[model samples]
Target: MMSISPHQVISAFDEVPTVGHCLVACITITSVLYGLYQWLLPNPVPGIAFNLEATKSLFGDAPGMIKEVSVTGEFRVWCAKQVKKMDSPICQVFIRPFSKPWILLADFRESKDVLMRRKEFDKSSFLSDGMECMGSFHGIYPTGDKFKWNRQLIQDLMTTSFLNNHVGPAVYSKGLDVMKLFEMKMNLAKGRPFSVKKDFEYASLDVMIEFAFGKNWVHTATGPQVELLSKLGASEVKFDALDQPVSFPIAPIMDFLESVYEAPEIVEKTINAIMPKLQTWWWSKQSWYKKIFDEKERIMKEQVAIAVNNYRSGHVKTGIEHMLMREGARAEKEGREPDFGSEVFRDEMFGDIVGGHHTTSGAMMWLAKYLTDWPQIQSKLRLVLYETLSTAKEENRLFTFEEIRRAKLPYLDAVIEEMLRINAVTVTREALCDTTILGCPIKKGTQIFFVSNGPGFLSPSIPTDDSKRSETSRAAKLNDKWDETHDLTLFDPERWLVRKNNGEGLLEDDVDFDGAAGPQLAFGLGPRACWGRRLAHMETKTLIAMLVWNFRLLETPPALSSHAGFEGIARVPQQCYLRLSKI
Candidate 1:
């Protein structure tokens, strides 16, 4: 070969890689590849349809959902739209990075079966974790001994005896207060629409507070506002606009009401967050959060003390007193001291106040919006109410709680059911073990969100492979199909009425209300379904009856009547404006 100089040999050796350099280079390449495989890539459960592009990205479905929420301010609608987008009754959505994908199930039959009969599913950690900040014990607990015990504690609150005898009058009286406030506003508006959202919230808070605390609990939000408004004449009360909806000043909310109102907002934020526990911790450290937490604690303690004293004096009438009595009975039976101040007791009381007020308020707000939109339905409903409660109408007085409850007015039922169907509530369930949903294998620990606004409830259902469905779901007798003759998406009350032919060989107007006439999960289903179902129905019906019976909900401008919703603990309407004419 040729003569090689020492300098050339040294230069060649210097260019060669050393062991230390090779080790560092190998580690850097391994880390990048590992990150792409583990963190950046979207690994989905097999056999479940998912967005192809979503699977290619590191953020997967989260970026799309976040963008949708940011633009529309509706997370609930975005959730339901994913099922339609996938064109599958059951689909996978990878939202949380590096975590298991969420299963979005749209089939009502499978959903019902899973909620009602399937033992493999239970309350997911997704729900419990979001609510854990409230307390250790409540209805959000997974199906277990703890959940059962919690249910037993508050089971009596929903009893027919307690609801009719105790809660009915309180809710009715509150409803009257709301009507009174609206009547005053109607006079001031002189045909202009006024925002009734705060009125609804205040009234609901009043009812729920009395229910949880007691009739003796005198801290009333609406009561004070109503009193304050009464002092001011029609001229004194100012309006921002004559043609559009007027915004009126509301009374300062009590610490208790403020705390309850704020708790759900925090819960919503934590649930939607990527890191819920960390988010909750951060929230817990905030001054506002601490104030609300402490305020709630102070109010609960004060109310419980009052309730205990009342119970001793044989004045037990509210939900908390009933709970204390239950604990006492349990303590007597078990021969141990009743833990009246237990976390379970406090949390359950607070939970009821939080959930009860929000759910009822949302439904009522929506009912007002619907009434304004469908004047024919509203007039028909009003006529039905007038005829059904002729005795009260003739007397020029509102119907009694018992009278409304005892009435067999099918149209009223149809209206409420339709409202509920169109505003279907979402329920989330977790696969307790490895299971198959609609024939697709769902891994254990998967969170399956049951949304009612999609598929069978509000839109045409996605094509499902019936052969793949579980045996129970396929054979479910309670799987009732919707009548697609009418647009399933429209807000039509007649869809819930069962019209039969008379002996004259003609269709009769005497239709009976059939709640099972279609697919809906408004209050959920199964044993774990909303225990507050009866309470919610009664409150909504009574309030709707009272409002329709007392005033006609005149239509407002399109801007004032927008059906856009803000998804919180419930999907409440953004606008609940009403132009009222006293009957």
Candidate 2:
């Protein structure tokens, strides 16, 4: 079913000889037959078949995903609707025309089963291969022995102690820098709507860079736009949804990394089949890819050089450095050579930066937008923050590290959980071998996406079987902490609150988020979940508190909200032009 028509047609035109013409005709006709065969092939898996027509693209679903998904943030909501409408917790959807349909599991129980059965379903090499195309292979997208090996070092570096003593303090320090920049923007605004996004980005990147390389690069990397966001746009735009187009600078790198999300057929098989030769050809001369790739590797090598020099001088300050040291020691003890120079190790650090940088920022941005959008929820959260971090009131400033670290704030915890659920981060996996997920014949090498939003939404409603009961009452009975509002479409932090049945909406303790499987797949499920999730939570809550304490962020035009489209490997918040008033 692979394409061969163009080459054969070319070959036929090149010669008029009888033998050559006949061969070309045969090849061209055979290619047509093969393509038709693939086109007419039936679904290989046994399940209810559904396809998002918009998700169809030249590269299969990838383009549709970019247009309707990464840009608009509609994928999760649509999936949740489909699961509810069909009444099937698990279903199948074609990734592209003529590609094997991948399974989509919406029910928590089945999804958890699929997640736990790692022997049959594990991380795919589709992204691993794409990373190689960029410059090097990454441990972020791998399975089996390689994942375990990389994981050991990652675990040591992201341990609780490292986060508390190092990463936490570092984030707080950078967050203060962000607060200062926000002050500049506020002064320039004179009570107007402006984007703190650039400052937000710098702060997140600043923390991550220091965490990864023991250095701060935000001040140097920040653009003039940071100081001018307020004056560039009018204050009127913040009162309502601004419907104008806003340019995103991060599009290119996001597009480059986007191959990781391509359909199983296109990326998993086709890219692997075609890219290596093309890569070899393009890399030889002054091609666009060659120049970009060179620049990328150049940056990585430069950082690696600095990090190594610092380590030798007893100046290691980043988690990466600690990870490498632990890994090196372990390798020495095992009498095996450590691989600091390997492409895998180098890319692992790159992966951390790429993975951590915008994602945390994007999540924080969304949390901010939601806080603005959901004013009632904001009031509740503010109350919780004030009561929990009461030490802050002494000076009426940002919460200290110790105050922020004080035991869990139920509303705050619930808000973070709900934000992640609504803005679900997707994880893609391929069947490690021929296997069945929930009795469906999952073909080998089929890339399946495990989405958190669908299950996270559904789990809160699943345990209660009485549909006759009010949705709110049923959902509350199942897990009262945050089910006060049953409208899943809206942002409700109270959904994570414990419900006490006393003829009134009463919230008690915080839900056990760490162990909660159904709704709390923010870091994903089972062993292959996100390694940096704890740090993600810590930084997000800390940054959120910093923002909330310093100012009262009012609503933006819907056009410049978290729901706005900003396309990339992941969906990001765009044009968040909130009205910021100093508290």
Candidate 3:
């Protein structure tokens, strides 16, 4: 009514906005700011950023074959060199582009600390994923209450008695078979240059199959199991990027021929394949096939059915059966439904075969290599074996567990310890929570790593006249005077032996045999340690003793240096080329 001018109208429009319009604008601004804050402050610490440009800068122009990949994305270095130079254990930080915060422990003490606390931390996502893929047949990848209960059940199965009575026999019989194969092959070649790894694999597979299935597939020299085992072992070492997040793709391929036609996929695949007919016989009696649909549950049912039938019929006498019958009976008496799943028994058997066979075989191959490389040590070992075997009866001819226990062969013990120290079998456990480790603040979900040695391995801090010299100076001197003059690089078992005759040595010096006894992180520590440790030790020692007792192993000359060798993972010998002759 007051005849508003155009200038006045424009001023009013600019001064104020509708309440709805203002609210919408404010909401948009808040969202953008919140998104920026999230981008800046992520919860889980982001792992090492993958910089393709940085990677290329470090290793792109490097010459020759790239031997190993470094944790820092650097390449073109040998594994040994990486082990010496890299700060992280196993030469890998395990920090993928999106992986959570990880602290890799290269120092042995730090590794011990982490391993000692198994209850607080669990297996990393990667290992769990791997077990899930490979162990779907037996429900190995359980979670929550099921996982806890199942793990307890499996632990009971791995008792000392079961290993000594059941698993030990299987290992011993297989070891003898391996010795026979070695003798046969050496005879055929007339002590020619041959890869020992292949033979070891055959032996290991034969043993594992027999233990799992209750029969030896390789007894008939021309069996599919032999070939399949070889293929499986070979494939096991190669890392498949595709299987990183999930392991399903590789499971079916383990039995490709059988799986190709989809011929009634029954019985747990992977470790339980060898005992398929036995498992199927048990499964036929179960009515739960119509009720259970979950893959793991179904497979667990089959394994449990086998275990239950065996227990009831008294067919299976040892291993998981013995443990289950004892524990299950106790639980039932206490008015508690054991709640012990079939998966528990299955995992115990599966874990024994998977964990035992390969590791023992690998160790034997490495020991053989060490003996061949250092003939003096081999001579000493043979002398000891001869001495031990000479005084034994026919019944005691084989190196039994009791004999190894009573035998105070320091040199042999030292050699085995040294080999294990130098080449650890596996890097186990990872952090699942944010925690401080060795004063270092590790974030949640970090891949905590452990190794066999620390700064002591590379830099001698032990107070000796040699310690006065700086590591750089010692390294330079080593380079200048590096020859076959008892170089540490040269495998020397005598370094472990105490030379009492050397009058130059002081009597009360603190000799640090740091890793000799105590707890070995190799088989793990505390309750979660390897269940088949004794069986593995017996198998490895027996095989090695048999070989050293019956045959002389010598390294091939340079003319035949180029030969197929063993490939390793974690801490395994890649290959061993040696000439074997009957003693």
User: In terms of TM-score, which candidate is stronger, 1 or 3?
Assistant: 1
**All candidates: TM-score:** 0.93, 0.75, 0.62
Q: For candidate 2, lDDT tens digit of each residue in 480-533?
A: 244423666667655555543533322234233333522555566766767677
Task: For residues 184-288, write the lDDT of model 3, one tens digit per residue.
Answer: 445445546555665565466555545544431224221333333334432343332321211111212223122211111232131112233444455445654
User: Whose lDDT is higher: candidate 2's or candidate 3's?
Assistant: 2
Q: Model 2 Cα displacement at 152 (Å)?
A: 2.9
True-structure lDDT of candidate 1: 0.83
Query: Candidate 1, after superposition: displacement of residue 15 in Å?
Result: 13
C-alpha lDDT of candidate 3 relative to the true structure: 0.49
- Cα displacement (Å) at residue 219, model 3: 6.6
Relative to the true structure, how large is the alpha-carbon lDDT of every model? 0.83, 0.60, 0.49
How badly does each model clash, as a count of residue pairs?
0, 12, 2
**What TM-score does structure 3 among the candidates reach?**
0.62
Scored against the true structure, residue 258 in model 2 reaches a CA lDDT of 25
Winning candidate number (TM-score)? 1
